[model samples]
Target: MFQKILCIILFCTSFTYAQEHLIVIGGGKRPADALNKLIELSGKEQGEILIIPWASGEQEVGFESIKKDISALSPIKVVSAPFAPLTAESKIVLLNQLKTAKGVFFTGGDQVRIMKVLEDETIFKAMHERYHHNVVFSGTSAGTAIMSEKMITGNGKLDVIDGTQVETKKGLGLLPNVIVDQHFIKRQRENRLMGLILQYPTLLGIGIDENTAVYVQNNKSAEVLGESQVLIFDAEQSKEAMKLYFLKKGDKFDLVKKKKIKI
Candidate 1:
């Protein structure tokens, strides 16, 4: 009887520890409902939730506003992270909090700011560890962009003569060799995404639109949710185009199959 009880206790403990999930929201206005859903999936309804609003111009305003907005979701507790003038001590505090957080939310702002803070090894390790243990890591807008390996930073203007351009950078690589772009369809970001794909055909380009999300599981499969579509551009099999002009919007590239299909 004691052996059976011990086995049951161990099983319960293991089950409780295996519930991590990532909710990546595309940039735009806001996504309150999606945020709540992510919280629900995290499994700990009454634990600490860390909100990082480092990406906005008025970091304080962004953080406070998000706090108020998220209040409706009624997270057990919400803590704001230090934004401007980042300090090592403050970052360590944030990392410590993240180590046992029920869920972490990255507010929309500037991806650059988010990148700067996440570059720290301690914070990165804590995040990766928590995520591996099934703690939810959620981000929106610029927050969403840095979740992947190759991050797209510039606006997707796509006109060199007109001076409109898009820039790409090395991302946190938390998601591995994946390039993530936000405000996808609303900004017609496919052109820039395709450009990146043409250069590195083996990499996966994920274009997430406003109010939508893609939940990646164990870094292998992802499921799309929300009002918009997640455009996945896979170029592993594309024969190098002589001029690279044949590719157009609405073109489909199968990530799993590594082939192109008409959208």
Candidate 2:
């Protein structure tokens, strides 16, 4: 009976990890197919998606537009959680809403804005709790930056990579052992991403191009999607200069093993 109980407990832990789903998109034209996939993973037509537009400067207008776009996906409900002054009543309301949400979507703008508003909130903790079970999470651009614990701030333009040129801050911690960079190829952000990875070799770097995305499942594997490519940098695998790999749509990769797979 003791052995059986231990086996059951381990199985349950693995099951919970397998249920975690995340979609990180590069900023540009929103990919309709990827959005639909997110909805499908979030319980499809019956899903209730919570949109957090805290990252955008124009909160009200930004959230309104986000709601309209998500609604077009035919989900049962799409709710917006604006970046507002939090109060006891407000926190309660937000937490209540989050409880029933099948998915949470973060919009694009300044990553710092989202961090400042929701970092320490009870609602953030609530979302993290739901995430482990089955709640699907999606974010774009600056919203994408917040998915990792060490988020890259899109500051200081440079054509060449050097560790000192980039800046980073604590992120939402949704994706561990990783740092994400958005608007990659279009903005010539290779150096920026390289700088961060070189400075911190322990962490893996994922650079996403505009109109492209990486759909990560269970934090173990990720697949490339959308119009462009997703770049993966593994400093540990390098012998001399840092090496990088580019994955296009339909390509699957093992996040933990750090290798491309047939999927």
User: Per-residue lDDT tens digits of candidate 2, residues 1-263?
Assistant: 99999999999987756588999999997687778878888777778888888888787777787677767876558888746665677777778878888988899999988888776667678878888878999988988999999888776657668767778888898999998999999988888888778877877899999999889988999988899999999887553456688899999989888889986
Model 2 is weakest, by summed lDDT over 10 consecutive residues, at 236-245
Provide the lDDT at 90 for model 1.
82
Each model's TM-score?
Answer: 0.78, 0.91
- Give the C-alpha lDDT of model 2: 0.84
lDDT of 1 by residue, 203-249 (tens): 77788888777776556656666677777766666635412212222
- Model 1 score (lDDT): 0.70
Error of 2 at 58 (Å): 1.3
Candidate 2 Cα outliers beyond 4 Å, as residue runs? 2-18, 238-240
C-alpha displacement of 246 in model 1, angstroms? 19
lDDT scores for all predictions? 0.70, 0.84
RMSD of each: 5.9, 2.3
